[model samples]
Target chain A: MISKKKVIAVGAIALAAVLTVSGCTSRTDSSSGGSTAAAGAGDAKITVAFVPKLQGIPYFEAMNAGGKKAAEELGITWLYQGPTTADAAAQADIVRSYIQQNVSALIVAPNDPDSMAPLLKEAADKGIKVLTADTDAPDSVREVFVNQASVEGIGEALTDQLMTAMGGKGKYAIVSCGETAANLNAWIAVQKAYTASKYPDATLVNVVYAGEDQAAATSMATDLMNANPDLTGLVGECTSSAPGVAQAVKDAGKTGTVFTDGLGTPQSMAPYLKDGSSSASILWDVQNLGYLAAWAGDQLATGKTLAATNDVNADLKGIAYDSSSKVLLLGDPLVITKDNVDTFSY
Target chain B: MTLDERTKPAPQSGRPAGSSTATAKRILPLPVTGQEFVLIGVLIVLWILLGIFTPAFLTPNSIQPLLVSVAPIALIGVGMTFIIITAGIDVSVGGAIMLCAVIVAKTMVSVDIPLIGAVALAIVVGLVLGVVNGVLIAYGRVAAIIITFGTANIFQFLALRVFGSSTVNGIPSTLEVFGRGEAGRTLGVPNSFAIMIVIAAVAWWYLRHASGGRHLFAIGGNANAARLVGIKVQPRLLVAYALTGALVGLGACFILASGTATLDQSVGSGKELQVIAAVVIGGTSILGGRGSVIGTVLGAILVQTVTSGVTQLGWPSQLANLFVGIFIIIAVGTDLLRERARRKA
Candidate 1:
């Protein structure tokens, strides 16, 4: 009787396992086998694969869209996939899988740049075109870095936009995500130095970390406002917190009295921008960033050196590639407001 | 465990030995446990300290939003307390929340669902998912943790498919009556908090006085013995889980009302841990058969208070996590001692 019961239990577990596996078939298809571009492996066309920080997020999906568009226009095969969570080891495994597949080019927006550095070196050793985009691993032996925007570009823009709403003077606090996020910290440093130099009247009261959780950001933003009742400005240092701070301002009925800005996607920030809670959203053309990464990958695979200022597309013109630092600039960061919010689909 | 005392064949007549004597003498009829007093004391001290340290911490502007944030976690904790008392768990609640919130949010966007309709839709969806969990664990004779964990992944997969690579933007404000706005409150009390209190009070009475609720304790204590006493253990267990699911549905709507106009896929990530943490810290014995809905509500409030207090005090966010971890360990330690004392007596 015990054995019979055990068998039934085992069968139920196995059934659930099958159900879950079938449900995640799409994610598995991409991460395990790359994209449909992998079907043309034997074809003569160059295959440039871009692995994002993670999958199923609007940010990386937008980048993937741009990569696919580039592949169609440039006549190259663009493959895109990444881990489901923003995890380092899982991401390393995905990168390793692409390496073993021996794709023509592998571009990674590494979740952990240090751990990914060795993998990039190994891929470069295998003669696979290696490039980093959206983020960078400066110490790695990569051919080029497709930067979304410079730290100065993002930081100064955030400050300028918030200052515009705060009228260049008043106390503000920053609700940043991931205290140890290297990129966020870099941009914050720039915001501080630029604000001190340019908007000297504005005082940064405090900077708190709320992680990637939107609700936490909202509550923290509320706390910040309560902490500093006279505070007139706030900065949500990541996509999650961008809408979060704006929501807090609105919920507290401080929309007109206080202001918020952040690195938010157009769609997420549209309501806030329209309601006058958020002054502006600072972001780059994510699709164009993806296109540039794929374009750079193809250039490297075909042994072509990029011009200092290359015209990749009509929408993306005079893309600057600095050989000395191996950084390709996607020009100034695009400031998103209610006027242009509907223009971008994502 | 009073193992020797309860093993005397339950007297063949009077209340199944441990069911009455064990619950009444040691636990019930007191309305509140010793653990609850300690929890209340800790909350009082923390609030007083926070009020002193951060002057704004005691103000209405700060406390109102903090309670608004606490409403959902506390609301869900009421149901989680019932499930945990039955010695079963539903770790899939986070994934369940994600699925329910996205569905309700989508429906509201496409069809302009009213407040009652949106809430009704969420509860029904949550009920269906809960039923799936109930049937599998009760009938299949599987461990609750393993079953719920598996269902957790499946639920997330379905939710993400519904999301389809984009966030649900421009969600209508129809659900904002439960939000932190003026519409969400009545006579300075947030409607969501008031509603959670009413439900938790009902749950409290049902668990304390109702025969069906007492049967849950019996089942959690010993399923075989409860079955011998004609307690219908499987159905009681099923109700525990299904109840949690319905609460998860209501809680998801509360989460929606509190957030911004957009709902992302991260709507309910890591919430299971938070809910379980609230349950565990509420002095709910993981071993089963002992807990209170009131304690669980207080646990949720205490946890949110710690988080908001940290921010208001301008302390590092990691400190809030540290305090919560410490509270969990201490609560568990005290529960262990009490269980040992009960066994010896």
Candidate 2:
């Protein structure tokens, strides 16, 4: 048995030694781990982190690849972290951790904008730059939003493709991913408005929510076709649902008669396009959108204020910045048909 | 706790001392219990109604996919039935499925192995995970739910670490034989569903005729009494969980085949609840002692039917949960009433 006083003294000495060693290591780590460069006035590598709603999907994975290329070109470190599932609370937790790490800048495509606003505010208050990409948060929540295209642009493009397939007038329904997803809701609202104004003969009959499950979305699409005999078109509001709806249309053996299009990846929509189950899909240059987002994050990190006519990147020419809404436009949506779908792969 | 101190009522009058099968004298007209009969009747009614309302509901294109989706859940429910019968639960199987799926998926992507080898690899991995859970719970003397909940997070971390990226893409057509396409079916029946039926039938047999199976019910009914009679309680408990893990591995293969070429990390999210729901809705008691794998298979079919029926009817898909909740209440509520009546008798 050991004496209690001697044990206490020895334990105290060991604790002191451990603490001194840890304290010295932490000091050196902080000094050398880019904080000094981040704090310096010039010639420092900006570390910008991008958080997606969820990782492992083709879309976000493509975005990360593009962001990595941009980071390499711009001489910055691009850290990617996100939840495995699309849970708003998980996204908020990741954002909070990033805030604690005190990165130079953060580019987030938030799962829930309202819930993430406070965390974004904290990151901003800590002098770390904040920006939104692919999907915008509220105007006040981000420094600048790098939007692929305006909601109206995408909505009109999709509706136009559907109308053309329907011979300019027909009954159609919208199959959306989530009922309350901010980006999906915004695009749906614009698509409905566009259909009402542009094509009076084409009617938007119903809007179904599938909650991002492929099977659920496919079933909903088939049910829509079954319930509405005269239905001639479908607009998939998200990437995953687009292929699902197309598969449903093919399963129902209404390939040529019923046309489908939406915001989708080239790979998912390729077979459908080739088989004439879907006429076309509307999307922007995802690679460019990611590149522009990383460039913006780097710009904000390096203490440069974004204003109109800033000429952010040499490669992406003629890009305009909106000061009031803090949105950077990435230009018009491109249409991928059977002839051109082969060229694009996410 | 003593026999009287257990939370739930002990073995009722209708049940034999060490058996749940209706071999003892009973006043009820049929040997089969009310829950199983009620489930069959409800399922028949639901199917008839769905067919009448939606002409497309009875088609092979729709029914085949529905059955394909039902296969994995029911297969796992067989083992879950065994676990729930012994008054233990394994919530970590979902995470276990994830780890198995990514491992199998990555292996298939990297190396061209035979189908049997792929399946064996998945099952072995699952067995190891299940044995870990069994040893911790049975030997450590911890509560099954609490220990499983902790293991669930740990297993998820392992799966995520294996899934360094977001999704595994460009997977080959090696798993197409078990997929929903033309190759996955034989004689107009999905191979996965057929395999599930075969496994469930074997489980139903073993539970009815095997002494090891009867021992599980004995342990569930009264562990102290069973121990006094010289039954090894701890090893039996371990077998139940290890069996569940093995089934989860096979079921993960079914899931891998069910989807497209891309396998995502959300492969097994919330599956543990699905399996539990199937087991309980099949009239299996969560507290312990009473259940059947046959009822569990039927319960899985019933749950899938509701989901497919709701979608085919053009009704709100979310309304299926409301119907499932009602079914759970009715199934378990009547079982509770029956248990109380038997105790009073």
lDDT of 1 by residue, B45-133 (tens): 99999988886888889888988988888888888888888878888999999999999999998996788999999999999988889
Q: Compared with the real two-chain complex, what DockQ does model 2 have?
A: 0.23
- Per-residue CA lDDT of model 2 for A1-346, tens digit only, reads 1432454465466556644543343334333434433453244567788888887677788888889889899888877766666767666766776676678889999887877888899999998899999887874468899989988888888898999889989999988877778778888888888888989898988788776655556657766676567889988777767866886776557788898998778876777788888889898888888888898998888888776765656667778789988898888898999899888767
Interface RMSD of each: 3.4, 8.5
> What is candidate 2's fraction of native contacts?
0.13
Q: Kindly report which residue pairs in candidate 1 clash with one another.
A: none
Lowest-sum lDDT 10-residue window in model 2 chain A: A25-34
Return the TM-score for each candidate structure: 0.92, 0.82
Q: Where does candidate 2 chain B have its weakest 10-residue lDDT segment?
A: B1-10
TM-score for candidate 1, please give it.
0.92
Q: For model 1, what is the alpha-carbon lDDT of residue B129? A: 86
CAPRI docking class of candidate 1: acceptable
Q: Highest lDDT among the candidates is held by which one?
A: 1
